[model samples]
Target: MSTSSSSFPSSASSPPSSSSSSPSSVWLVAYMKLKFFTRIRRFLRSKAPHKRNRAASDHHAAEKPRIIDAVVDDDEEEKKDTDKSMVLQKSVKRLHFGTWEEKEMAAEQIQRLARDDVSAKKLIAELGVIPVLVSMVAADESGRRRAAIKALLELANGTYTNKALIVDAGLYTKLPKNIEEIDESTRQEFAELISSLCSLANTQSCPSSYEIISFLISILESKKSSIETKEVSLGALYKLSIVLENAGALISNGVVQTLLMLSLEKQLSEKALAILGHLVVTLMGKKAMEENQMVPERLIEIFTWEEKSKCQELSVYILMILAHQSSTQRAKMARAGIVPVLVKVSLLGSPLAQKRATKLLQWFKDERQAKMGPHSGPQTGRISIGSPCNPREAEEGKKMMKNLVKQSLYKNLEMITQRAASPSSSNLKSFAISTSSKSLPY
Candidate 1:
């Protein structure tokens, strides 16, 4: 077998060659395959550390963005916190600034802040600006005082808690003393502030209510006050009069007399009459109105005038309320000559006025009938004295009927006599006097 393998050729004896023709070719192929595998192994070995380093670098590159983002997020959060802290620090710093102008600006800022409920609460609770504002109000400088008032007014306009803060700060008591020193506009501002405070039902319990009532009354009664001051004061009083406790305070402050005096001024008459209507709601108010004859008297005159439609309407409305107080008030109104005016209003006034006037007229009629006892009616003008009623009441009703009849007759006679003495009679007397004077001159 060794001799045969050597003779034929070891490669040929090993296998039949369909692709390779020689041993060298086969050897070259084997050598190329080995070299390829060796180079592949070398390439793999050489690339291993690089691949690991590249993977690590890629991982670090991805993580770097996340780390930077975390840092950036932290930085932004710090910036936002810093901004909020800066705003708060600036507000506080400006609030206590040394310059009056700066302080006034701060106050104005506070005023603007007080307009919002959350900010107003912050101003009062967190910052405690109310006492600062009150000090500014009592400041010697008018500018500061005015600024402070505006701030306080805004503060009062906020939530009920803010209003309580203002009231507790003694703003109500301090404002009145500053009235004379301030301008008319400032005084009006004060009146508006009081009105705003009094508008809240919760503020009714505050002593400021009565104090404000008295302050406004004083303004109304002061002859030296401006018309604007008086007007705003009347407005404030009107607001305060709606509160039951304030009504007593108003009456005690002699607001009735002040309103009576104010009613005479044509510019102020309508508002004064409007406030008077509110005042007459309470018992003390009604009693005060009754005592002041000018109140009913002026109301009756306004109702009769018929020129000022609003004033006339308000006057009649007030008279209607007063007339309903009691039989005595009805009698007083009748004595004031409001009955005939009411009857005319019922006939010729506006729809609303007519309706109110008609009711009032009916009220008067019913009161008259009530006074005249069960037997009296519209047809029976006189009270029946011999009826089975209270003897004293019958006697009183009889006297009242007699006085009314006498007054009616006297008014009728005066009208007839005026009608008899006409323009023709006056012309004839003037001609005679002129002729006599001419003769004396010649």
Candidate 2:
């Protein structure tokens, strides 16, 4: 085939007798070879376009899905002509009654199918496969547990129903007893899955028991745990803290101190402070936080964080709750030198944080004024703690005070008279003299 290069392929020089020498003919030949690829660019396709995302949702049509993936997918319909049954049925049965190897295989398959197949996810849960897979998570074999966890993670994605199912199956109680016992990879997988499921808390009655809290705390405290794992654990705990009822469980498990310690870490501080913000609202949470030695000072340290504005916001929020109606706690915060920090945050922090800091500053100011009333003033007289002599009696004390005042008045009048004029200016100089009548009654 000869060629030309004017706004066409070099092969366009070939005469218009059907030949594979041009770009257009090349695609046409490939389309002839394939089966269902009838349309040119897979758009405005009359019957079926390219099945771009074969998941539950399809954007080709309106919000209503064009054709179901599991029931009648493009790929399966062409290949499995005789076996028209859905793979979901076979997979559920095998997962339920299959042996060890079969169950693992079934989990892997379910994870794959349920990944993008939202329809298959609901179907798999409807077939009662979730509880079985959850049981597999507790299996002694590491591979079995990992497979089940991965499958459950897939099933829980964007589906509240599957998450509730996993929780109902006691997944909270199924966590590994010790984070150290499991390898790092499995621990991370567990954390990720738990973090996903923890979203179902508070809005519904998902049992966010202490077991889950302790498991997450273990992951957080683990030295071997990755930053990502700790972050996931922190997120789970934060979700659990949303419900006021879970405060006791979280507090009893000592999440307060751990969170207080972690909130100082700049990277992890924001999420950790968020959880503490939720907990600090409750009475018990307030008490627990107040008792921690790191409360106001450590939290005050967060305000100095000019970069992490969110952390500064949450830290100030917790401090406001701590100093709300409690006078003693405010005293402690005042002593911790939170006044300067709050002023800085009120000036520079986020708007919400600024408001909270302003409120706290007002409270501190009010309490300080109340404790020392308008008439109650600072000490002008020097009173030393190591002084051996005692204060004089009331009458003698009054006399001494009067004498001191009179002497001070005399000194002032004498200085004024001297600065008035020289003795040569007789009239004006004499008029400025400190006469006896100039000293008023003490």
Q: After best superposition, candidate 1 residue 242: deviation in angstroms? A: 1.7
Compared with the true structure, what per-residue lDDT tens digits does model 1 show for residues 1-442?
1221122212222222323568777666455444433433343233222233334445556567665665566556555434433343344445543366777887776665556435434433345667778777767777788888888788776467667677778776675553455667777777777767766643544653566766777666665678887777776666666556667777777778878877878889999988776666566776788778686777777776566777876777666656554677777777778767776775666555665666676666656556655533234344465656677766777776776675565455444333333232211111112221222110
The 10 consecutive residues of candidate 2 with the worst lDDT sum are 1-10
In model 1, which runs have C-alpha deviations exceeding 4 angstroms?
1-88, 97-102, 112-125, 202-209, 223-231, 265-270, 305-310, 325-332, 363-442
Q: What CA RMSD would candidate 1 show?
A: 32.3
Tens-digit lDDT track for model 2 on 312-336?
8778767766666678888898888
Q: lDDT for model 2, on a 0 to 1 scale?
A: 0.70
Tell me the whole-model lDDT of each prediction, alpha carbons only.
Answer: 0.61, 0.70
> Per-residue lDDT for 150 in model 2?
95
Cα displacement (Å) at residue 271, model 2: 1.0
Residue 171, candidate 2: Cα error in Å is 2.0
